[model samples]
Target: MKTIEIQIEDYITNDKDLISVIKRVIKDKKKILLQAPMGTGKSSLILDYLSKEFNILMAIPNTAQIETIEKRNGIFCLYGDKQQKGYRSETTVVSTPDRLLQATECFKTKNIDCLIVDESHELYTTANYRPKFKNIMTLQSTLKNTSILHMSATPQANLTCLKGFYDIFIKIDSKKKLKTSIDIYDMELNPSNIKNIINKYKTNNNNTFIYFDDKSMNEELAEELNLINVNADNKKNNEILSEIKAKNKINENIIFTSVIRAGIDILNEKNAVLIICAKSNLTTDDTIQLIGRFRNNLSKTVIIKNFKNEDTEKNNQSYEQILNQKKKYLKSINDDIKRWEENKIKYTKEDCTEIKKKLTELIEIFIELNEKGEKIEENHRYKINTHRVEISAYSQLQKNKTKNIDNMIKLLEKTEAIKIENIEKKDLNKKANKSFNKKIQEKSTEKRELKNKELKQRIEYLSNNLSTLQLELFMEGSTLKTLEMTLEKGQREDRELRDALRKTLSVVEPKSKYYKTIQQIKKYITNDIRDAFKYITQRELSTCKKDIIQEQIIRNNISWIKDKNVEIATDIIKNKIIFIRHFKILQILDNYGLIKNSSRISKKILKKIEDILIKEKYFDGIKKKNYQKIIMQDLELIFNLSRNNKEIRISSIKTKNMNIENKKQTA
Candidate 1:
C-alpha cells in the first residue's frame, strides 16, 4: 500500500544469489528455469533483479504483481492491472489482450532489455482465445538483445526435451519438499459422526475453519454450520476470518474448503485441518501449494476424516504407479552415477540440485503412503460409515489398452466377434476362407521405377508449360499497366479542369443580370427593386457551351425574351436581344412575381405562355391529361405577362466611351 521509489541500480546489492544466477545465464545466453515454492519469495527475488538489473518488460497474470512495480516507481516497464488502476510514469499496465498487443507493437519499434514472465506455466495451456502468451513469444523472436526470464512454481517436465533449449539451467530445492504434520480424528460419538466432531469444537466457541474437496460440498457444509448456534452468537465476516486464522494456528476445529490451495498464506493461524475423502487425489503441485499456507514452520494438525465406508483402492494404486515411475527414473540416474568415472561424465552442483528435486518427489510419495497406512493391491474393499465399497486396481490399468484392444471389446459387444453361440457351419467356412485368402493372396503394389518415371515426366512437362505461360502473362500485365496509367492520367486532368470552371461560375454574376440592368434603366421604375427581380435572372452556363447567348437563357431557363417590338440595346450590347413576349416556361415557379432579381428557377408558364412554350416542344411527348394541372399553370404565367398588361421588360446598362474621331472633326 505504501509508495516505493526503486531504481534498477538498487537491485545490484539485493538478493545477490538470485541476481548472480540470472546474470550468469543471461550473459551466456542460456535458457534457465527457476523452480521454487510459492512462498519462498520466487516472484519478488527475480522481479527485484529484473527491476534493478535491466529495463524490465514483465508479463504477470494479474494486478498484484503490477502494483508492486508501480508503487516502486520501476522504470519503463509493462505490467497488468485488473482493477482499472492507472499507469505510473514508467509503468504501463496492459490489462487486456488488445492493450498488450498494442504495447508489443511499440516494443517492436524499440529494444526491451529483458522479458520477465511470471506464472510461466500459463504458456503451455494457452488456447487460441488466449493469445497473450503467443504474442509474447512473437515479440521475443523480434527482440535480439532481449533475454527471457520465465519464473514458475510448476514447469513442464518435457520443456527441457525440446530443441534450442538443450543446455538449460534447472535450479530446484530437492531437500525442501514441503513437510506438514497431518492428523486423523475419529469422532466415535452418535449416529451422525461428523456432527459430533463439530459439536465438540463449537463448545469452545472460537473460530473454526473447515475445508471441503469440492464447491458443492463446501456450500453444503456452510449451510449446515449456519443452522448451528452457540450462545446466541452468529458467524459474521470478522468472526469467520479470525476463526480460520485461529484454527490454522492452533491446528484445531475449522470448516473445510478448497480455498486453502494456491498462493494464499495462513502463517498466523494457530492450527489447521485437511480432510481427505476417498475421492480426493491431490497432485504433488497442489499439495505443495496447499501446505505452503502453514507458514509458521511450527507443528500443525491436518485432520483427515477417513469415512469408514469409502473405497480408496483405485487412488492408492494410481499413487503407487506414479511413485514407482519416479523411483525407476532415479534408480537409473543413481546407477549412472556409480559408473560415471568409466563413462567420463561429470555434473555440477546445479545438476545435482535438479536431479535431487526429481528424486525427492518420488521419495515423498512413498512417505505419504506409509503415513496414511494405504495398502496397494490388485483389488480392495473398504467400509465407510456402514456400507462396503469395492475399489478395483484393474480399473486404472484398463486405461493403458491399445486402440485395437478397445475395438475388439466393442466388436464382441456388437456380436461381430464371431460368437460361438451364434456360429453355424456356413459362417465358419466363410471366415476360414476369408482368412486363407488374406494370408496367401499376394498383395501387390505399384513398381517404384515405373511410378517415378511417370511422375518425373509429368512434372517436367508441366514445369515447361507453366514457365512459358508465366513469361507471357508477365509481359502482358506490364503492357496493360502502362496503358491503364496513361488513361487514368488523362481522365484525372479533364475532371480537374471542369471542377475549376464550375468553381469560377459559382462566384460569377448571372448573364441575365446584364440584360436585366439595361431593361431596368429603360422601364422608368422609381422604387427600389423588389424580390420579383430574381425571376428575370438566368442560370449560368457550363464551361463546355458552344453558344454563350442561347445557353444563357434556354440551357436551364424557365422563361425567355419574346416581344419583337422591344428595341435591342445594340450600340452598348449589339448581340443582346430585347423582346416583350409571353415568356414561356418548361418548369413552373410557385409565384413568378416573388422571384428574386439574381436567381434561376424553372417553371411552365400560364396558358398563353404554354402556347409559346409548346412552340419549342416545352411539353413534348408529355400527355396533356397527365400533367394538365402544371400545364394550366404554365399557360397562366404567359397570359399575365402577355402584351396587354403586367409585362416587366429588362435591359443591360453600360459605361460611356470617347473616340479619337471627335478630335479630328474639331481640327
Candidate 2:
C-alpha cells in the first residue's frame, strides 16, 4: 500500500498537490482511503472542491447526515423511498449506504466518476448491530469498477478486507493547535460525578455537552440536571436541535447518546464536553468522534471517566478455528437434510426443497467465508456473514483500554495541544457533598419563603374582614377581651340606637313593623361579632399547630413528614403490623404451619412461637400478644381464616373470595 500524509493547513491553503495525488489515483483506477481529523473540513473539501471536477456520489452512514449535507451544500440528497432518477442530473449527490446500495442498478447506468463513503468505519464497526451493513457489502462489490474514496476520522475497520480494493491511503493531520483541556477522573461514572462536573462547568457560565452510551442514563441525567437530552428514543430531536440553535439558550447543557455522535456539528463556543466511558460501551474511537462534534476553535474543557477494560480473550477465535466450527455446523445441517429425505413419509417434499435451497446458499456463503475470511452465523434458519466483522471490531475496541486513552492524552500534551488534569476521588466527593448541601439549603429557603407568603395572605384576609374596634383589640394581643368588649359594645350601642329611633318615630306608622326592624338589626350585630371571634381563634390555633409541627420536623430530621396529611400519618403510625418489616414474621409463621388454624392456642403455646421467632431475629421489638394478634388478623384478611368463639380455623376459600368481593364492588 502506498501511504501519504498531508498537513490540513496546506490542504486548505494550496490543495493542488493533494488534488493531483487524488487525480492520479483516479487515473490509475485505484481505491483511496482518506483519514483526517474531524472538524478539519473533510466534507467541505469533497462538496466544494471535488464535486466541481468529478461526478461524486457520496454514501453517508445515516439519513441524518444526508440531511445535514444537503442543508449545508444545497445539494440533492436521496434516502428512504425517494426516486434516484434525479441523481443522474446532479454533480454531487448524497445518500445513505443502504439507499446507495439499493440504487446500484441506477448508478451502473449513470456516469459516477467517484464514490465517496463517509464515516466508512461504521461499515465494519456497526456491521453486526445494523442491518444496513449487509447492503454495504453488496454495494462495495457492485461498484468494483468505480473509483471509491473511504473517509473517516477514526478508520477502525479491518484493513485486510480492503487490501485488494484500496491501493492508496492518505492521512491528513491538522496544523491548528487544539485549545481544549481534558480532565480525566479515575472514578466510576455515576449521577454524583456527573452532577459535580456539570456544576463546575456551569458555574463559569459555559455550555456543556454530555456523551453517554446508555439511552436511559442520558434521559435520567438530563432530567436530573434539568437540561435537554438527545437520543434515539427522543421524538423531538429536530426540535431540540432547533432549540439549541435558537436565541436565549437558557438551559444550555445537553445530554446525548451515540445517535448523534457523528455527522452533527454544535456551533457553540466555550463548550465543555463530558464523555462517560464504560467497559462495555464506548471505546477510544468513540471518544475521539465525540470530541470532534464541537466545531468552534475556542478554548473548551473535556471531562472523561477512566476505567479498565474487561477480559474478552475467551471470545477471540483464530480464523482457522472459526472455519472449522462452520464446517461442523454445515455437517449437522446436511445430516438433518439427509434424514428428512429418508423419512419422506414424515417430511413433505416442500420441506425437503426448502432445506436444499438453504443448504445451497450456506455452501456458497461457506466458500466466500473461506475465500475472504468473512464470519458467518445462523440467525433463526438463515445464515449471515456479519458476525466476524462484529467480533473483530469489538476485540479492537476492547484492546484499546485505559492505556490507549492515557497515550492519546500524553501525545496531545507532548505536542502542547491540550492541558491535562487528573481529578482525584476525594476531590470529586468533596464537590458532590458541596452540591448536595447547596441544594438542601435552597430547598429550605424556598419552604421558608412559601410559609412567609402564606402568613402574609392570612394577615391580609384578617385585616380586610375585621372591624376597626375588633382589629385594634386583636392587635393589642387580647383575644378573649376583644371578643367580649366587641359584643358588649354592640349590645349597648344597639339598645341606645333603638331607644332613640323608637322615641323619634313614636308617632309614625305601626309599632310592630319598627319592633321587627330593631330585632333584626340586633341579631345581625350579635352574629357578626360571634363569627369574627370564631374565625380569629381558629386561624391562630391553626398557625400555632403548623409552627409546632415545623419545629418538630427540623429537630427530628424528618422533614418529609410535613408533606403527609395528618390523618394518613396517624394511620401509618398506629398500624404496627401493616409495616413491611413484619412481612418476614408472617412468612415464618406460615412456614411453621402456625398461621393456618388454631383454637386460640394456649397463651403458653403462643409465647413459645413468639420466642422462637424473636430468637431467629424475625420480630425486632414486637411483644407476644401483639405479634399473635397481628398474625391472626393478617391470616384472616389475606387467607380468609374464620374465627368462631375464640377459635380460629382455616376456611376452604382463599384470595379468590377477596378478589370476587373487590370485583363486585367495582362492578
Candidate 3:
C-alpha cells in the first residue's frame, strides 16, 4: 500500500489531539474516532489528508451540505438514466445509506481506495449504522486494506458498536480553549423584551441564527418577528445551508430554526445569543450540541437562559442521586483541565477562559446548595446540574405532607364496604347519563349528510370525465375518423376468425388443442404490453414477432359466423380502440404540459396508456372487453340524449328534496 503523510496544522487551528489519533489510526491501518463539537473544522481536517486517488465516502445528515461537499471534492453524481462513471480522481459525499452503498460498489468495481465517514455518530445507532456496516462489509477485503476514519462530535453510548473497526479514539475538547469566552445570563422577559434584544444584536451583525425547541414555538416566534418587519424563515435540514447563503447575499440578519441539535457551520459572526425557555428540561447532550455551534467561530457566546426552579418534593431522592453524578462528572472535567494547565500543555487562550467559566458555574451550584438548607462539606468538590438542584429542594419541603397523605389513605380503607357501595352506585348512574348524552350528541345527521355529499361529488367527477371523453369521440373530424375507419375494416377481416374462437370455447372438449392455443396467446399478450409501445413502424413488426404471432393466433382461431367470429372482430377492434384511447390521453397530457420531448410524443402516449392498463384494474377490464360492447356503452351512458336527461332530472329532484328538508328543519 502507498501513502502520503500530510500536516494537519494547515487545516485545523490547535488540533493536536485530532492529529495524534489520525496519525496512529493511519499507521496501523485501523479505523479512528474523531469527536468534536459543531462548527469545528472536522471536514477540512480530513479533506487535507485526501489525495487525488483517495476513495472517500463522506456522509452528512443534510443533502444540501452533502452536495456542497460533493462539489468541493469535484465529484459528479449520476441523475436519472445517467451511468455511474467517475470523471477523474474525485471524492463522493452522499446523503443516504442506499446511495452510499451503491457508490461503494462502484468504487470497488473501479479499484478506488480509502473510506471516510462524516457525522459518524449517526452510524453507531442500529437503524442506519447497522445496514451501512453490512453494505461496506461486502467490500470488506478492499475497505479493510485501505484507511478508514470516522468523525463526529458525539460517540454512541456503546463504543463497541464502532469498535470493530475503530481501535483509536481522539477527542477535541472545546472546553480546553482559553479565549472561548462564555457568559451565562438569567433573563426573565416577555415576548416584547425578547424581540428587542434580538433586534439589537441582529442590527449589529447580519450572521445570526435563533434556534427554538420545536416547530410550533418556532412558528409562533417567527410570526412575532415578521410583524416587526424582520425577515425570518423556518429551517429545514435540506434547505438551511442554501437559505443561509441567500440571506448572507442580501445581508439578512436572522435565521429562525428548531434545529437546535444538528451540527451547522456558520462563518464570520462576531457575537451570538441563545434564548432558552424556562419551563423546559433540555438534556445535557442537547445543551452541549447547541453551545457547540458557537465554538469554532471567533465570537463571544452569551446564553440567555430562563432557569425555572423545580419542585423536588416528589422526586427528591432521584434528583439528589443525579445531582451527585453531575458534580462528580464536572469535578473530573475541571481536574483534567487543571492537570493540563499545570503541566504547561499546548493550551490556547480559549482553553483558559473555558476553565474559568466552569469554575464560576461550580461556585454557583455551591451557593444554591447552601440556600437549599443542605450542609456543604469543606474542601469537597461541590457540583450540580440545574435539574437536580430543583428536584432535591422540592423533595425536602413535601416530606411531612407525604406521610400525612399515607395516614389518610389508611383511614379511608377502613370504612364499611356497604356504605361505600351506595355512594359508588349513585356516582356510576350520574356518569352513565353523562356518557350517553355525549354519544347521542356526536351522532349528528348534518355530519353524515356532509360526508355523503363529498362522496357523491367524487362519483360525479369520474362520471363527468367519462362523458367528456364520449363527446370528444363523437365530435372528432381528423384523428378519430382515421382510427374508426381502420378499426372497422380490421373488425370485418376478424369477423370469421372470432366466430371460430367462441365455437372452440363453447365446444371445449377436455383435450382440445384450439383451447390451449387461445390460452397461450392470451398469456403472450399479457407479457407483450411491455414492449408493444416500442413498435414505431410496420417495418418494426418483425422485431415484435411475439406480439405479431399472438395477434395472428387470436384472429385465426374464430370458427363460427356469430359467436366466435364476433370475439375475433372484438379483439381486433379493442386493440385499435386502445390505441385511440392512448392517443387522446397523450393529447390531454401534452396540452397540460405534462409530456416533454414532443417528437416522440406518440410513443410516450402509448407507453403511458399501457402503464395505466397495467396499474388500474378497472381500465384493464375495460380494455379487455368486446369493442362493440364498449362503443355501445360509451354511446348510451355518455353520448345519448335520453341518458343525460335522466341524470340531470335525478340530480335536480334530489337537490329539491334536500332544500325542502332544510326548510322543514329550520322551521
Q: What C-alpha lDDT values do all the predictions have?
A: 0.36, 0.52, 0.39
Preferred candidate (TM-score higher): 1 or 3: 3
Q: Which one is best on TM-score? A: 2
- In the predicted model 2, the residue pairs found to clash are none
How many clashing residue pairs appear in each of the predictions shown?
A: 60, 0, 30
**Candidate 3 lDDT, tens digit per residue, 297-395?**
434333344444333443334433434543444454345435434533444343333333333333343332443435343343343433333333332
lDDT string, candidate 2, 386-406, tens digits: 444344535443344333445
Task: Output the TM-score of candidate 1.
Answer: 0.35
Model 2 ranges with Cα > 4 A deviation: 10-14, 81-88, 102-109, 158-164, 177-179, 235-238, 243-251, 275-279, 298-306, 309-382, 386-667
| Model 3, runs deviating above 4 Å | 1-24, 36-40, 76-95, 110-113, 124-143, 156-165, 172-208, 226-243, 246-255, 259-264, 276-282, 291-667
Q: Estimated TM-score per prediction?
A: 0.35, 0.52, 0.38
